[model samples]
Target: MQQRTLDILDKVLYGLIIALFVVIPFSEAGINIFAGLILIVLVATFVITRSVRGLDRGIWQPILALLIAGLLSLFFAADKGRGLHKFLSPLVKYVTVFVAVALTARTDSRRRWLTAIMLVTGLISAGYGIYQYGWLSIRRVYSFSYNPNVVAGYFAVLTALSVGLLTGVKSRLWQFVFSCTTLLGLGATVVTFSRGAIIGLVASGFVLFTMLMSKAKNKKAVLVVSLIICVVLVALTPDMLFQRFRQIADLENSSNRQRILLWQTAWDMFLDSPIVGQGPGGFSAQYEKFRLPGAGDFVSAHSVFLQVLAELGLLGFGACLWLGVLICRVIYAQLSTSDQDLEFGISLGTLLAAVTVLIHGLVDTAFLRTLVGTSMCCLAGLAYSIGLHHKDESSETVSP
Candidate 1:
């Protein structure tokens, strides 16, 4: 009876995880509801089985530190009540989903299912964005989000993941699916006209190509083919997109100037409360006081790292760095392993996905949005699980 109950709970946990991934790209409310349920189910699983085999300390430790830092920063916020709300809703919620998914999606089969879901949903979203841009005469496609930039960042990460999967998987069918997903994701990102997203996608693509070349049997052939593809893609790109890229350096561009002002404001906020900072949601609350003379009214710092530093101070920033370092360490270790199979491809893809978020985050608040942030965290968790599982199997084999 106990064994049966545990099996049932495990099934429930897996179902909830699937549901969470399905709704992630569509609705923030869905994320909240499903994430909450998953957490509850995860806790129940822990209590029933009295086991924490897959939940690694390396994964949770930095997250716990960030949470603690955010909590402490709340005391220094301009509006403590709002800070508390911000801390609980997205900050705490993101952490919960990350840990829960890592624990539940332990096996290769489960992780592959989740990745397929993400690719399908991402493709659908990208298709919708393309339809809006071409048929509906929309200037910028936002997809499911209100802001085009947010959706751009989301698509950019998916693009990197698709590329990673394309190179990693052995199956031709899966490769074709990822190929379509990658192209559509790139198209969706272009329609959004977000320079930051494009820059990030390019950077991550370079990293992916480099990694692939390192593992390829014929390096010269790979390099030549990659160059040819790049040239073809560049030739096919629309003139309008090229113009948008040029605007990144245009001083006359209002958006570019505004972002600079917002970044400056974030710096001012950090200077004011260097220790703990202004707390969660502190940037918007204290924006007026720190706003540059000609800067327009805005909420976010427009940069993830800057916003974290401004809100949670150096301590919170350090915690974030800690988390990033740990994730890189785990993924790198996994990539170093001998097996270059589907799981290896996944680790490579997730690591590049993270690179997209971090690079885009430098120019836009990519990681602050719920969908993008949680999605990246989910991928990170999956990568962590893969690394740990491989290590355990190796240990068992060596012990015998």
Candidate 2:
């Protein structure tokens, strides 16, 4: 009877996770609802199972520190109530999703199932983007997302996942499928015309290809096909895409100038509060006071690292950095010892997804958006879980 109850809770948790990936792209309310359900089920599962065995508990330490920093920053917040709400709500959502995935997805097949759902979600979003571009003549496709950059960043991660899947899956049929999705995702990313997204996609793609080159048997064929697709995409791209490249070096570019000004203001805010920061949601509220002369109207700092510095100060920023380093260390260890192709696929896909988002985050709030951050936390959770559950006799260790 106990076993049956545990099985039922596991299935429910998995279903909610699937719901989260599917609805997050389309509806914010849906994400909230599904995430809440997952949290409830996760609690029940934890109590009934009466154990946290096989879950990677190490990743939680840095996350806990970051949360503590955020909570403490509220002491200096302009509006303490808003700061507390802002800080805790998303943190709870991110932690809930991470815990749900890490605990529920115990087996390799279960992990792959989650990835498959993510791929399907990406494909659906990409298809919508293609439709918007081809039929509506939209120059930049945002699809269901709020901004073209957000959709582009999302696709950059998906494209990396597809590349990882291409080499990781053993079956020829699945490889072909992943290849098709890769091209589709890339096409959608191109239509978005997001410069940061493109750069991140390229960086992650290079990593994925390099990893595959060392392991996969059909490396030459994959390289040839990928190059051919790249050439075709370049030829078919609109003049606006080329214009974006040309404007890259031009500091006077409207958006580029704005980001520079915002970054300057962020530095000033950091100087004012070298620790703890202005508090959660404080950057936008306090941005005008710190705004530089001739700066345009803006709410966000437009860069994740700068925004964190302005809002959280150095202590919170350090905690965030520590969290990132811990995650990277966990992934590195997993990738180093992964003997199975399945583990390779999960680790590579997770790594590329993270790297792509982080690269994009350098120039934009890629990791701060609700959906993106949640996705990122979940990916890290998946990698951490895989590392913990790895069947090898040797145990993986991370030093403090």
Can you give the TM-score per candidate against the true fold?
0.94, 0.89
The whole-model lDDT of each prediction reads: 0.85, 0.81
Q: Residue 128 CA error for candidate 1 (Å)? A: 0.8
- By lDDT, the best candidate is 1
Residue 360, candidate 1: alpha-carbon lDDT: 92
**Candidate 2, clashing residue pairs?**
none
Deviation in Å, model 1, residue 58 alpha carbon: 2.6
- Residue-pair clashes per prediction, in order, are 0, 0
Tens digit per residue, CA lDDT, model 2, 1-400: 9889887888888888878877867776788899889988877877887755566566668777888888888889887887877686576687788778877666788887877777888799999999999999998999888889888887877787787767677899888998899889989999999988888877887776776678779988979977996788779888988999899899989888888998898888888998989988888878878888989888778888888998888888898889788877877787778777767777787788887887888889867776677767766677767876763233544423
Residue-level lDDT for 362 in candidate 1: 97
TM-score result, candidate 2: 0.89
